[model samples]
Target: MAYYKEQFVFDDGKPIPIIIRNYMASDLEGMIELQAKCFPPPFPTDLWWNEKQLQNHVSLFPEGAICVEVEGEIVGSMTGLQVQFDPKNPMHTWEEITDNGYIWNHDPNGNTLYVVDICTSPLYRKLKLGQQMMQAMYQTVVALKLERLVGGGRMPGYHRFADEMTVEQYVQAVVKGDIHDPVVTFLLRCGRMPLALIENYLEDEESHNYALLMEWKNPFHR
Candidate 1:
């Protein structure tokens, strides 16, 4: 994997330059657009940016989210939330509300890191910018001395729907769902393991799909 300063380009006339710049609230417009191009149904525009920063989410990154830019345009991004899921600082409010219940209470001394989202434009596939993003993401985790990092990754194939469909189209529709992304592949490439497979999970109405939880251990998290 390359560092933040490394620049790698593929033969497709596209260059992915890695930079540690923050994903400022100001960059939400570009971020949202890139997110749309990257995902079947990207996050809504309202949550893309906050007039004022919000905590308890990826926006908690003090350095802001990390992004990839190609020719001065946002092409990819990676963001994380800093949380310590100890008896003192639990992962969330309730236990049954999440799958974290299965994770041991090792967080008593371990800080939990949530990889909220890692996205990249389809035009830049196989370019390895996602690996760079994961490498940078680990740097952030190490800097914060986090113990566990968790996030749901799309399965290898999921149903994706089009904007509009005909009767026959809806009956035999081919949703452009993608279950793989650079970040998850990057984590696996970096020795992370797939913890479990979640089925029929959806973050929202438009995002009905399954996901996997990928995790990496860092003894250096201290």
Candidate 2:
């Protein structure tokens, strides 16, 4: 895919220029650095990405792997693969979905666009770069004629209520609008919904390694 550039207007009436483009070998250092800044230490054991893993993902589905740049610095990125999964039985962890970071399970002809990660630099968080990356992934799904977008939505606020309620209870509360989970709330506002609660999706203390199996069907899809 060719580079896609656009300007987004901020609430302050200032325009921020950004480019959404395919991942390149040269972006490895910036991508890794940006991810580190986005997700700090004291997190999961294998929640980070490496050069080899990125190479594998790019080799498998180059179009699904995309990054966002501002003034030539990689600030945000989202990775995904075409996959075939049953919506009723979507039981999976992050490792299993991306094949333990190897991403060899990518199927180009699959019916679903399985997004793995969508992150943005801390410096650019106020710019809504993460949402932009998601929009880029959605455009990819449309371009590929996929049925929908699927992924694990991390609940950034789940850890606060973990001591008082079970994971299921927390998820149900979020779904019913009783609670506001940062990640889940954002996904919901983007027209996506959680199908199930996934456990051990990662090894993070914030969310207790739990995630939501989120899906967003293509409304324009036939």
* Candidate 2 lDDT by residue in tens digits, 100-172: 8678999877999998888888888788877878888888888888899999988889889988999898888
TM-score of each: 0.62, 0.91
Q: Candidate 1: misplaced stretches above 4 Å? A: 1-6, 12-18, 40-59, 86-110, 158-187, 203-209
Please provide, for model 1 over 72-93, each residue's C-alpha lDDT reduced to its tens digit, 9 standing for 90 to 100. Answer: 7878887655545433322232
How well does candidate 2 score on lDDT at residue 183?
88
Task: Assess the local accuracy of residue 71 in candidate 1 as a C-alpha lDDT between 0 and 100.
Answer: 74
Lowest summed lDDT over 10 consecutive residues: which window, candidate 1? Answer: 170-179
Clashing pairs in 2: none
Reference-based lDDT, each prediction: 0.53, 0.83
Q: Local error of candidate 2 at 174, Å?
A: 2.3
In candidate 1, clashing pairs total 2
CA-only RMSD, every prediction: 8.8, 2.0
- What is the alpha-carbon lDDT for the whole of candidate 2? 0.83
